[model samples]
Every structure is written in structure tokens, then in C-alpha cells.
Target: MSAAFFSATYGEARQRFLEAATRAGAAVGHHVHPLTGAAGEEIGTDTALLGPADAGKLFIVSSGTHGPEGFSGSACQLALLNDELARRAADRGIALLLIHAVNPFGFSHLKRTNEDNIDLNRNFNDFATPYPDNPVYEQIHDLLVPAAWPPSADNEERLNAAMARLAGQRNPGVSSGQDKHPDGLFYCGTAPAWSNRTIRSILRAHGTTRRHIAWIDVHTGLGPYGHGEKIFGRHSEETTRRAKAWWGSDLIVSTATESVSPRTVGHITGCAPEECPDAAITPTTLEYGTVPNPVVRRALRGEAWLAGHPDAPATLVREIRQAVRDAFYVDADDWKGMILGQFRSQALQTINGLAAEE
Candidate 1:
């Protein structure tokens, strides 16, 4: 059962992913990160390639773009590695590429972003041009990440007020990439981070080889419990419509225009087309919701605040990290079962869609 696949920590999850991929006969490879994990253990992005190496259509399934959320993604990827998935994908002449732990540092440290304190999803923009700016994030930046571990009453009030104001304007969270604030909650890095570079390299290598590509990046911390939300941003409506055709009509598609998730700049899915221009790419995120928005935001703020305050108490640090991790992942058998079932259904749909293209 998938209950056995859910891991308590990053190291265990990575180990299990590798073992399952290898046992299932995937061609395993890895890109080692330069930095070490919190436990002084090494971390890296692992890739498991199934089906023909030179297949014209490739379906890339990724996990851990948000670090702590990788646990569920990793589990799904592992669960999806049985002989049946491999055979079905092969029958469609589709190659399945499982990229596990793209943000290993965050996954290992139980944080949302990478070691650079940059959101991996937001760090994928073109550096040659001017990065996107959000004045709203700047105005409420300080209030978002408080000076203390457990924010003071006044700090809470100010933040709550700002959130309400932002909400009244139809949005509040400042997730659009901000290069000015390095220590902020949703700090988009000033330059390409390691994970950004690594993913691009992957797309160029594998994506360029394929005539058509379908990518599903696993995520959590939004939507109903165990439900997988299909999220898209920074793309045209044509792309969204085509994605619906490829994935399914029932898929919940949310763009920056009307998403509960803030409108953002650089996103990982953009890599397939940008890096491999000749390939027709279909990409979207599988975001599984855990807790409600307020609870998740509080957990994120707590972790973001703790990032600035290293002197915070040990107990508080543990609690905050755990809370944020929990926000993205629900460590229960039923939740795991729900995720695995949906992943399998979506993956089969992608394979069938690719076969139609063939």
C-alpha cells in the first residue's frame, strides 16, 4: 500500500525513490547539489528515466519543487513505478521521466525554498531582462516576516490588517518574485539558483530530444485535503486550453489571473518550451491541498520569520519547521492513498494524450 511509501524525512524518501526506481528498472541518474543538508548529509536532484531513451514523446513527472512538499511527490513517483505504469507508458511509446527532489536542500532542511533562500518556482525567470516587481510585496514585506520568532500581538495585528487590505483588493500574498528582498518570504533570487540551472539542463538534454513533452510537477499546500489541484501561471490562454485538451476537461486549472496562489514571475514549467523550442510542451502543477489558507500562511510566516532570527529558541524552530512541513504534507494513509490514486489517473491520461499525438 502507499501508506508504506510515505517517509518521515527527506533522506528516507530519497533513498526509497532511488531503490524503487532501480528495482523497477529505471535508468537512474543524479545531479549533486554543492551544499550539504542540515544533517551534514549530501543532497541532490535524482532522475529516473523509464521507456525508450530516444522516444519521441516524453512525460516528465517531478516532485519536490517546494522542498518539504517533495515527500508526497516522492511517494507518488515511487508508487507510480510499478510494472503496470511502465508497460502502459511504453505501450503509448511515451517515456516517463521521474525527477525526484529538485529542491533537495529545502527538502532535507524541512524548508520551503532552496539553500539560497530563494523560491525555486520563482527563480526561473530570464536574468538578462528585468525581473518582475510587486510594489505590494515591498510595502508589506516587513510585516510579513516579523523580527521575532513568535510575532508580538501588534505584529500580528499589523500583518492581519495588511492581509485584509490585500485581500480586499482581491489578493494579499506577495508571491510574485521580488529580487530586492533577499530575506523575505517569497524572495525570487537576483540570479538563477542551482535548481533553476539544473532543471534547464535537464530540459535541454531530454526535452530537446523529444518531439512532444508533457510535464507534471507535484506540489502541495493548496486546495482540499488529498485533492490534486492543477495550477498554471504566466502562460497564455491557448496554452491553458491545450493543456485541458491534453490532461482532461475536469482538471482544475488556475492561472495567476484567478488563482488562490499569488501571481508569480518565473515558474519551473516554463523550462520545457524555453529550453526546448522544437518540442511541443504541455506542463502544469499537481498541487495537493493540506490545511486551510490561514493555517498554511501562519506556518509559512513562522518559518520565514525563523529564517531571519537564527537566535530563536530550539523548540520554536522545530515547531515552526514542522508546522510548515505539515502544511504541505499530510502524513496519513488516506491522504497518501488519495494522492497515489489521482496521480495514477492523471499519468494514464497524459500517456493516452501523448499516444494520440503519435
Candidate 2:
């Protein structure tokens, strides 16, 4: 399946994924013209179905919430649909839902955030939480997005220092600590963005009736190179134990271990489970590794540059866009192989896990 879609762009990968899902006899639903992109592209996110609509157990795999990271997830979903797994899903009475490019605007424009620069992951918390203020983010906001095209050396130093301070905090709660960077990385939005709202709505519509649900929101740009960390949706002992017993060796609970992800605020799956309390929702993020964290931060700097300077040179814009893509996904055969293998393994494990529950 990786051979079929080699080094494809986000749009290309998404289209191929949808085609494969349809070929596998999956019903498709499109959120047509739901949002517009920065370049005014009519971006529509689509959800493909592979098994029965009302199966007892539902396996939901979504990609591209962060936009550029969708390439790898999209490819993995397409590969799984093309493989024998889709047939197995149908046979086992497990409903397989493949959501491609949840953030179509970011995917098309090669940006991680949406048109309004809202990080969808951070926009999922309840409004009652008051959008947890980030004073640190506010302080470094200007440094991250400079008035000039490319940031100066001093600006880089200041940004690096702030990131170092934030990253060094060992406490889980500290990661989501308030910062004053309105235009910096990990900027939680002023309010719930369109993507967050749409996902919550989808969960309410599709996820409410399921007896058991296993959601794997695909992501990238963290952890060891090429490794996919299975981050649990919430920090619960029972859920962690269940994930370990069900998914076995592939599972990496971020709440339990400090290896992959630190506990943070505003997760998409976390909100989904909260919204659909009736269902036994087991949300796990399949985060594939790309560059190192520092390198990823640098790539994000480039993204900020592009976002802050709309009138930048064409060459710089192209370079920044490509850099952001490369940061999350390496266009190599081995990396693609890892992506497909990890996703397939986790998907099967999740299906088996749900079956065990039943």
C-alpha cells in the first residue's frame, strides 16, 4: 500500500485515502464547504466508512487535526483499507471509520494551525475552563512572530530560552502553563475553533450510540524518530491497564510514562469521551515520530514566519511550507513502512481489545 502512494502530498494522500475507503465499500460522508482556507480554498473534510454503521464496537481513526501531520496518517489509513484488514473489520462486526484531513485548510496551505491560527488540539476544552490563560505564551508572542520577514538572531535566542524553560518543567501541569505568546507555538485559541466544534458535533452524532469505542487520532512531530506512541485520552488507571492488556506492547500511555507525551491540556479525544459519556470511549493518539523536538520547534518558527508575513517572497514561502511538511513526515520508504506497519498493528490490537470487552 505504501508503494501505491509514494511521497504524495497531503491533498493527494487524502484523495487516495477516500478512494481506497470507497473501493473497500465504505460509506462516505463529507463536511462540504465547512470552512475556507487562508488562500480562500474551499476545503472540505471527509469521513469514510468501512464496516457496518451500527456495529457494537467502533474503531475510529482520524488524521490531520494538525493539518501537515495528516500526510502520514492519511497514508496509513489508505494502506490499511487496501490491505486485508478492511475485510477482517467487516468480518468481525467492527465498524471502521476513517476520518481524513480534519483540518483541510491547514493541510492544503501547509500550516499546522487553521485559518485563524487556532491549534485544534488546544481548542477542545470546555468553555467553562475559560481558555486557560498562557502568560508565558503572551510574553514570547512578539518574539515568535516578528515584524520583519525572518526573525533576527536575538529573537531566536529569546525564543529558544523561553522554550527551554517551558520544556524543562518536569511537572505535567507545567506543560500547559500560561504563557503570553499569542502568536507562538502551542497557542491555545481564545475560543473553540471550527474544527473543534465540528469534531464534538461528529462525536455526538456517531459516537453516542456505540457500546465500546476506540479512537486513534493520528499525529506526528514528537518522540523518537519513526516511533508511534499510543497516548491515552485521559489519565485513568483502569484505562491505562486496559490499554496495556488490550493493545499490549504497542501501547504507550502518556499519563503513566514520560517517554512520549507529557500530560497536557485540550486534547480532541479527551473532549470526545467527555461529550459521549454513555460510551466506553478509549481514546489513544497514534503519534509517529519525525524530527527531534528542537528541530520541530525550528520548523514551527518557519511556520510562524509564514503566518506573520503574508507578503514574504515566493521562495521563502515555498521553503517554509516544505520545511513544515518535512518536520512531521520524512519522505522516505522506510519511514512510510513504519507508519503503515505501526498503524495496522495498533488498529488490529484496538479491534481485538474492543472484542475482549464485549
Candidate 3:
């Protein structure tokens, strides 16, 4: 019954999410993005609120900030929505909020970035203050985003070697966030993005005066196959200590820790806690691994290259798009089942933890 909830396209996923939310007796709202879908349909991020309107404890799950990665996130969201997950949360006196397709434009366009070609995860920064300067990303920017798709053997080796250097002993500097290079991977925007504004708005409304809040931003790529890494971040030591207590010792600290992925600059989940002053917030990312770093880098580059050449041959476009999708989302049933299982466990854990706090 749950497996059928996974959809092949953004349109299908959105429809399933809406239907499941409706069935779960949730009030849903759409923040329309200023972009059109592939088939001329409207593009927007949808939010579903299930449970008491003014519930002090809230559990939020957001998907698709990276676009294609939304597939896994959306599926897990549907599975929970169609099942008894929300009811259980409500029983615990918690409101379950599901924000679907934060970057609807990217989800529809087959690009990881939004319509402005900005990475939503990396776009969370103070405009008054300067964006983080990633010297490493700048040094290898051209190599990452080439004019040609599937660079020649010589170019591929060079780019790989440069990337290898970035993946140092600690694997620290290999991030996609860079503000200077807009056309490159991990491009942080100069201004707040539509998704950023919309998400912040939701957080401000739903997060205010909440006694406890647990947020899970779903993602894929990085770590062992089919494993969900509970990567967390916080503003201070007290918050960090409380979060560790809430999420348990197994959770990975996104910063000041060793991990397969690089430390992000402006993660959206990390910023949510700041919006909720009185709430004891625990924010983390459910990052499921799909493939190795090399494979993932190749797919990201291919997608970026494909974006650069919209006038390219049909066959080439088709090839890159499929590669990018497979890199982010595994089509196998066993893989998706693993995701759903973890999602269920985590959702339950969140409810238990929040309920205890209350």
C-alpha cells in the first residue's frame, strides 16, 4: 500500500502528497513559485498542517531543497501521511507539518538548484553580512562547470585530481556552496530565494512559542547505501547538548565532526531554530546514501553541463538527466523500502522525544 505512493515525476509526487494530506485531514497551503513546470503547470511549494493549529510541539519534515533529491523525501512523506504517523503525532499533542518541494522549479526542471540556479540549502545567509568565501570552490570552479558535457578524458582526469585534493585527509573542503560562481555547482544566491522566504515564513508562524520542535529536512547522496544519516546542527553548545540528548548519540554533527560529506555553510534546517526563540528545537537532515562521492560528482557535473547547453542534442540531454536522477534517487524497491523504514523509526522517535519534553 505504501510503495504505490512513490511517484516518477514531480507532478505525480505533488498530487500524491496533496491526496494523502487531504486523507489525513490536514489544511494545505501552496506558496506559488514564480516559475512554470515542464508541461506549463504552475510551480509552488505546498505545506500541509495536520493536528491542532496552535500545538506547542511541532514535527516538521521538508523535502526537495536540492530538487531531484526530493524524490526520496516526497516518498517517505507520502508513506507517513497515508499511514498513522500523523495521528500518532497528534496523540502526543504534536502538530505534524510537511513542506513538500521547497524548490518546485528545480524539481520540475531536473536541476538541483532553483529557477535562479541557486542552491536553497546554501542560500540561507545574512544579506547584510557577506557570504562565506569558499576559496577551494572558487579555485576549481571552471573545472567543475565546463562548457562541454562529458569532458574529454584529459579534462576529466584533471577535474578528478583537483577534486581529490579538496577531499583531503578530513574530507573537509569538498562542498557545492559558492556565491561567486552562479553557474557552478552549490551556487549560493546574493539575495534570499523564494523558497528561503517561504520556508522562513512558515517557520515564523508555526515555530513561534513552541515548547519543542523537531525538524527533518530529507535528502539523499553521501554515506553507505540506503542508510539514513541523522546529521545535526545548532547555534550554541546548550542547544547542541540538548539536541544530542534528543536525537541520541548516533546522530552525526554536521560541523566539528568527521563525515562522508562536507560541512555546509548555511543549511536551512540549522536556521529554523533561530526563528523559534522560546522553543527547544532540534533540527537535522535525514540524508540517505545513494552512490559514492565520485559517482555523485559526475552526476552533478553532468546535470550542470546539461543546464548550460539547453540547445544540445536530445540524446545527450536524455543521458545526463537520467544519470542525475539515478545519482539522487535509487529506483529499486528495496532501497526505497529502507528509506521508509528509517523514516518511520525517526518519526516515532521525534514524537517520543517531543512528548517527553512536554
lDDT, candidates in the order shown: 0.83, 0.75, 0.82
Tens digits of lDDT, candidate 3, 1-358: 4467678999999998998898888999888887798678888999899988878889999999888899988998898887776898888789999999989987877777788778888888877888777787877778877878777888888888887776663323647377887677887789989889999998897788688888899999888899999887635787677667777788887664565557677788766766887887788899999988789888888877766677999898878878878888888888888889888888888888888785
Q: Estimate the overall C-alpha local distance difference test score of candidate 2.
A: 0.75
Cα lDDT of model 1 by residue, 140-183, tens digit: 88887877767789988988888777773423346666788778
* Cα lDDT tens digits for candidate 2, 84-138: 8777877788888778888888887888877777677777776665666555556
Which residue segments of model 3 deviate by more than 4 Å? 169-172
Output the number of the lDDT-best candidate: 1
Q: Enumerate residue pairs that collide in model 3.
A: 176-186
Task: State the weakest 10-residue window (summed lDDT) of model 1.
Answer: 168-177
Quality of model 1 by C-alpha lDDT: 0.83
* Descending-TM-score candidate ranking: 3, 1, 2
Summed over model 3, clashes come to 1
Name the TM-score of candidate 2. 0.90
